[model samples]
Target: MCTAAEWDDFRATGTRRPVNFDADGFVHLSTRDQVHLPANRLFGGREDVVLLHLDPARLGAEIRWEPGVPTDPDSMLFPHLYGLLPADAVVAVTPYLPGPDGLFGTPPLP
Candidate 1:
């Protein structure tokens, strides 16, 4: 997930190197079921978050399944993109808002 402005820039440029990409060496991603973990951890109460639904087939082989933070379940492995994220690879985009409790919840699948 990313801020609305960031998403807009990504859509305009057709590709993006997320802020943490340089430090982390990959674009962080999550499955529908696990997205809330990172969203709540990183974005929390922010209302500017938006979820980008990407087409895995278009992502090629640079994707890797890797371990997330220690707080996550031991079996959970997040998807990390090792290259620029092409905007065309995003099939959909949706506003990701937090609840009144100031924490993100799992969104219904598209």
Candidate 2:
């Protein structure tokens, strides 16, 4: 688990994205901004959430997003976990792996 101080450090960096931890103990940082949707689908739209796993070392990050739920009616879409994250939630630090573009690398889904 990450300590409060570490979490604060991540937030202080001013980065707005979820960090992820891989099964191999690597960390990945997301380079994208918050997802956006149509005006009528901001809150009550289908659930589109990002999934992040944290490394025990606190030195890396990994990031993933769940497919949007068709039943959601929100205009803007941000990756999030349904019923898991709060409205004002932000994940600053996470485990990541180096990618070809110098960002976290994502493996092909099976």
Candidate 3:
């Protein structure tokens, strides 16, 4: 997922990041069922966020499943894309702003 501005940038550029890719050397991804975990943990109260719905098979990167956040036993091995994100992989994009309580809920499937 990306921030609202990042999504805009992706739309404009047509090619997206390899960005932090996480320090583990890839772009971190959360499954549809577990996306809220990372949303609350990482973005928390942030408001300018957006959820990017992507097609796994279309990603140009090498997507790997591995232990992303070690301390969190709930979601240890998450999907990580080991190269740049291509615009073709992004099937949909939606605003993912948090609620008034400053907690984020999962984005609805497109």
Q: lDDT (CA) for every model shown?
A: 0.90, 0.32, 0.78
| Best model per TM-score | 1
Clashing pairs in 1: none
Candidates 1 and 2 compared: the better one by TM-score is 1
The TM-score of predicted model 1 comes to 0.93
For residues 40-59, what per-residue lDDT tens digits would candidate 3 score against the true structure?
Answer: 88889898887888898898
5-69: candidate 1 lDDT, tens digit per residue: 99989989988888788899988899989999999999999999999999998875498999999
For model 3, where is the 10-residue window of minimal lDDT?
Answer: 17-26
Off by over 4 Å in 2: 1-6, 9-66, 69-80, 84-94, 107-110
Report residue 70 deviation for candidate 3 (angstroms).
2.7
* Most accurate candidate by lDDT: 1
Per-residue lDDT of 29 in model 2: 26
Candidate 1 lDDT (Cα, 0 to 1): 0.90
* Residue 29 Cα positional deviation in candidate 3, in Å, after optimal superposition: 1.1
Ranking by TM-score: 1, 3, 2
* Candidate 3 off by > 4 Å: 74-76
What is the total number of backbone clashes in candidate 3?
Answer: 1
